[model samples]
Target chain A: MSTTLGRISHGAGLILVLCFTLFPFYWMVSSSFKDQADILASPPVWFFTPTLANYADIFADEKVFGAIVNSLIVATLTTALSVLLGAPAAYALARFEFRGKSDLWFWFISNRMISPIVLALPVYLLAVQLRMLDTYLVLVLIYLTFNLPIVVWICTDQFRSIPSEIEQAARLDGADQFTIFRKIYVPLGLPGIAVSAIFSFIFSWNELLYALVLTRRSVQTAPVMATSFMSGYELPWGKIMATGTLIVLPVTIFALLVSRHMVRGLTMGATK
Target chain B: MRKGGEFVERTETRLNPGYGRWTPFWFLAPAVFALLAIGIYPMLSALVTSFRRYNITRPREGFPFIGFENYANVLSDQTFWQSLGLTARFFVTVLPFQLLFGICIALLLHRPGLGMLRSLARVSLVVPLATTYAVVGLIGRLIFNRDFGVANQFLNAIGIGGMDWLGSPTGAFIAIAVMDIWQWTPFCALIFLAGLSMVPVEIEEAARLETSSKVALLRHVQLPYLLPGLTAMLILRSADILKLFDMVFVMTRGGPGAATDLVSIYIQRVGFRVFDMGTASAQAILLLIMTIILSRLYIRLIYKEIE
Candidate 1:
């Protein structure tokens, strides 16, 4: 009887926690479909005739597509470059013994620990000097500063986990170091690469501060575009919510789908 | 000495893939070069700029080296201290709550006989983690509005009454704190859960047999594993709080007053709003030092070296 009571309370607590966790998300998505009047309704409308007008309003502004295309371009290239450059370095760190290896590893990871403010002024100046402001190449290069660390750290851990015997056999088969890395490790470390790619894409896609300062109209990202709609007295609440939901959709799907990997990604591979 | 050295060399050749000394360099060069050109070079440039009078708005003044004047100005600025204090206050406000709630939720999910509820709750937890931080700011704006917000309606339902969450200084601070907790508590929970999952079933059962006290079991059996994760959580969270900008920038814009003005926001104001890059760079370097010191100390004191 006592055990039954405890179980009941446990279930109740779980439900309460679930409600808190999902409530704001529900509110955001529902409000996206709301009209102007319904969005600002004081008591808050629980039930309403949902509409596509807000989404239509968002796309009606032609810059929205350009912003998304820019985000796509930046995120894709960032992911590619991170994996391409990171995998070989990760293999070195994982497989070899070297001087200052730990120092090298820490230096890579500590890059993320530096405040964006510290880099923002300098990066802006460098861009102006290079004449590379508001370009896809600039954003991709900037995105790599932090993303490369993530790729190295996670893929290092991943590469470490794959047995050394596999490499031994590949080497015995007369495969060189590069051949072994490509044939043996790349296929085996796909999950880690995918997770890192997802992380790089998500961060690059969602990042706003650098994107805001660096890009103007040409290479403006989705998050920047979302914030751009946020100015003035009569705020476009419905459209803002709609654009937010759209911006948030892919990440939410990725988060829910690969939650285990997402946790590892989030904690910078510290947890897993 | 000769025997020890020879023995070490034998094992090194066996385990080290017998590659040339420069092989690692070949693999590492591109990444190192990229980091230098993009990351370190710019940071060095910023470091040099911090000592000079380089305001973007005032080009006529020229780039004159002003020695420690910029640093002195940052040290003397009252708003800079106030912003630093607020940043500390913000970190303190949300951390304990996130830790407590996270551990409790993890413990709850770890409890047996709720497999169905467990899976569903796990998925829900990642939603906030995945949501764009700026969108979270937008969400904070809608939900914490003075008159037309669900926060007020819920308060009324609970008989606590509604206050203007974003209007008053204390209210705005609390508003940002709550949003931060909402977003990051899940992260803490996820980490603790990862720790808890490592606990052996036999050990947990053995502990349970000794006493019906969950606290005792947590203190004795589960805590050892959780400590490593906790240290990691602390390091990341401290760095994150110091650099926090996008969410608060969108949500509060450092607020109705200076209530939500974190150091990051303050520097942005200095650098972007005023175009005073020199002082801003100085401020950034100081914060960067603090971040490095805090994280390095955490790693040295407690964080288990990742193998």
Candidate 2:
């Protein structure tokens, strides 16, 4: 009886947790398809004729297309740049010993702790002075504040995890250090590096404060554009929900694709 | 780990002959340079700006040196203090529930048997984690809408009246916290799951045989092993929750009053709205110090063993 009760309670608890996790998303997606009146209906219209008007209206705005393009370009460039710079640094940190090695590692990792707001003011000011505002380059560079550290940190662990014997055997066969590094370690560390890339992409994609402060109408990202709906005189609940859904869909799909890796990526490879 | 280090050291010695000392430097230089340019340079500028009067809006009056005035002004400002207090309240309110529920849910999902249910729960949980903070805030607004939100409808169905979630101060605060908890509890659970998986099954089974109580097993067997993950999660989450801006900006815009105002929003307002760069920089510096101190504390406490 007790074991059965335990099983029953366990099943109930799982359902409860699942609901808490998913209900808001359900509301978001459902309301995106809802008409304005049905969205505000008191009994909460569980059954209604779904509409695509919100999605239609959002897509019709040229600014919305600009935002999506900007988001994609910024996130992709940031990921690419971070990996380019950070992987070699991580490899060096992992493979070589030098004076201040620990200190350098700590410094790189500690960069993650610096609040985005702390950097926002000066970066914004610098962007204005340099006439770099509303440009993809500025956002991509600023995103390095978080992305580079994550790439270096996670990739260092990745490099460290590869058995040294494999690399040593290559070295014994007269493979140069650079060739061995490029040929051997890069392929082995790709999984962890990919995880790091995902994190950087998602952060840059979802970033708002910097995007909001730095960009004008021309370069506004989707997330920043999504907030413009909130400040408008009319609520535009359907459109807002629609935009929110769009903003969330790409990353949600990406997260699900890497669901198995989510646990490791999120913990920054600490737990593993 | 030491063997790998030694192997690298030997390789460096072989590769460079006499100047292996400088080998890693070449690899590290670019990353460090980039950090200095983007991260350190801006920080140093903010530090300098904090000590001077430099409002972009008032460009006619050039940025002049004003030693400690900005810091003094921020210290004396009641709104600044209130926002700081509210930030603390927000952190205190949200983190515990997230930690508690996270652990509970993690424990539930960590249970050995239920195969498909466990997989489904884990997958569903991380959906919120994938969504942006701003979108989560927008979702919160819809869910906690005074009239037709799903939350109120659910409450009404269960015979409770709708509450003004974002209207009043307390309600707004709770609403924000709830939103945070909902979004992040899954995060905490995932981290905990990762930690739980590290525990030796033998230890758990042994503890279980010794004591029929789950709490006892967790306390005597699991908690000790889970400390590192807990500390890591705590550090990660604390750093994040302290810097929360996008959520509050979208949900309440720091509120109907200054009810839900946090330091991030406060600094943004002073910097942008009022164009008081000096005060904003001062506040930012202060926030930076607090963040460093708190993070250092978490790191030292939790990471002492590794060091």
lDDT of 2 by residue, A1-272 (tens): 98999899999999998888998899899999999999878868899999999899989988777788989999999999999889989988888767788777777777777778899888888998999998888998999988998899889988989987887778778776677779998999999888888888987899999999889977899999988888756599998998899889999988887777776666555576
On TM-score, the leading prediction is 1
Best by lDDT: 1
lDDT tens readout by residue for model 1, B1-307 = 9999999998778765558899899899999899998889988998999999999888998989999999999999999999999998998899999999999889888888888998888778898888898998899888998877888889989999999998999999998898899999899998999999999989889989999998899999999989988988887898899999988998889987899999999999999999999999999989989988976765565435564
Per-residue error at A99 for model 1, in Å? 1.2
Give the distance in Å from residue A118's predicted Cα in candidate 1 to where it truly belongs. Answer: 1.0
Give the docking tier of candidate 1.
medium
Q: Write model 1 residue lDDT over A174-221, tens digit each, in one string.
A: 788888889989999989888888888888888888998899988999
Whole-model Cα lDDT of every candidate shown, in order: 0.87, 0.86
